[model samples]
Target: MAAKGLILLLFFSGLVSSNVEKTIFLAPEAREIAHDAVLLGRRLPVLTPSNWSLRTKIDAEFPTEGSSQGKVSWFFLDNLTEYQRYEVRICWAATQPTAFTLKTYEPSVAWEQPDLRASIERFVPNSQQQDIRTGVAEPTSDQPRISSALVLQVSAAADYFTKNATLMSNVPLVDVDVVLDPYILNVFPRSLLPNAACIVLVAIGSFFVSRWVIALIDGLLRADAALEKKQQ
Candidate 1:
């Protein structure tokens, strides 16, 4: 019974320990700005990293069709980072080289991590680091020279692209809005309730086994006395 209880405890501990914590950083303003651009029938801001022009805008809040059920977005010319993915877009627009706004999802811990800031600098260097300001103005040009063509494809497959865009760019870098911290911490200590419940179950099972063993021993002793009395 003791061995059984120990085994059960170890098993539950392993299961709980296997839970991993993951972190990701994201600029919600990018998505918000993209949504507004799509709603107002306007082209989103662009940043050209290499010879290929790169543009980003959030198209849908949730992906309707895709293996990854993340928010839908349009990524032109591939600026996919290790943590970022682009969805479908309605049209492609010219790259705009201008100062862009980048607001963090979590302002408290956004700039605290040095590694995240380094990644942003390494991937996109032209963006000026500024305090996160709310209610940023949208870009509007009175004389629009180019028109965006429609994309007839219903949905894109799982494969976005083979290579990362930052590795292949050769053109002058433009200021692209990037969030320094893209990940949030998720602690699994909340799982302790289930672990405690399992431990209680093991205890109850052990109690029953112990009781059965005691009853069996008592019955054997009583039978031995009865047989001795019959022999006498």
Candidate 2:
């Protein structure tokens, strides 16, 4: 009886040791940009230039309903020569659990001209020009051009876990799935980008092999125990 129990324990231990699973996670960095534009019928020039950036955070839970969540923070700057106009848009996405996506839109424009007569003409010739002919003749190539910039920040997280004891613990198999989310950050130079989404499937077909290994060990231990019992 003792020998039989010993053999069974050894067999089950081997099965557990061979059934462990492995998983992976990722954390990405933020992105930034800079430039100029016109907003609401006003020309906004980047006097000191504009800047943009983004940051992201994520949390994931395994094998449960409503188990994952994420948050993204974004920032933007628009420098003006005098006064100018501008607009902004923001978007977010997730690739796991249920695949969630969101977007925010904001538009702004301003106009500010310099005080100096020469500076005013050099900076904003269109604002100084009175007649269409002088405006048309004054080297149109160097006309007060508008420049702007934007920044985008994103944060993300995920959770994943698998249980083998529930079903077909002795079988080998593989499975995979992917999710996606997309958003726009601006209207004029419309931003359209895709989020990551992919699934991988893998199965260990060593169930029968494991069972046989257990049987072999059990047979050896049983034989040794029988011999000992006989000797006693």
Candidate 3:
């Protein structure tokens, strides 16, 4: 009966341990920027004024489709005013026993337009420079024209089942190798190593406990036998 109770306790402990999940955040990459000038190189004759707009699509590396955490954004700078705006969209997923549901988050300010513009100007000042020459005079540089097209920011979360649990139906096992970022993982507590030394310590402790229990039982049995012999 004691052994059976111990086995049941161990089974419940295993079940609890197997349900742990690990979540990580992943940032999205900008594949290509959309704009009229980018499509038709600058060499093309300047035709009518260009009204530039762009769209980008993102997909998870694993599980192809469904809920995941990430952000998509569209960015543009008003060259005349030297101000920038990042229109962002964020989404995330929660997994259930039966299905996964995607939750979309409302877009909010990621960075101030003026601050973004200032940073860009400081890093790439020559980016705004242009070249011109005066007749019979030295050539002079002018501010380079900034592209109307903007690159959007994309961020997402990569989650994995760390515990020993069966995959749900229709859920694809993500096989992509992920190198965990040490900076982020440091925030979470990890399992201690189950080394040989620890195992030996546990075994020795169990052996002593079992011996003590068995000795008590054997003493009781002997007392009962001696009493019966005396009665006879």
Q: Whole-model Cα lDDT per candidate?
A: 0.31, 0.28, 0.31
> How far off is residue 194 in model 2, in Å?
20
lDDT for model 2:
0.28
Kindly report which residue stretches of model 1 are placed more than 4 angstroms away from their true locations once superposed. Answer: 1-116, 121-188
Error of 2 at 71 (Å): 16
**TM-score for predicted model 1 compared with the true structure:** 0.27
Clashes of each: 6, 42, 9
Q: Estimate each model's TM-score.
A: 0.27, 0.17, 0.24
Query: Model 3: per-residue lDDT, tens digit, 1-232?
Result: 9999999999877664322222332222222222332321221111111212212222222233442432221222121111222222222223312112222111112122454333323322221231111112211323333333222222223345444444322233221111111122333212223455588899999999999999999999999999999999
lDDT of 2 by residue, 1-232 (tens): 9999999999877654421111111111221211121221122111122222222222222222432333222222333222222323222222222222222111121123222222213324332331111111212232333333222221222232347454322221111111111122222221222212111111233666688899999999999999999999
Identify the candidate with maximal TM-score.
Answer: 1
Report residue 80 deviation for candidate 3 (angstroms).
50
Over 105-163, each residue of candidate 1 has an lDDT whose tens digit, in order, gives 22112224464333333322212222221222434554322222111111211213226
Q: Which one is best on lDDT?
A: 1
Clashes of 3: 9
- After aligning candidate 2 to the native by TM-score, how far in Å is the CA of 118 from where it should be? 30
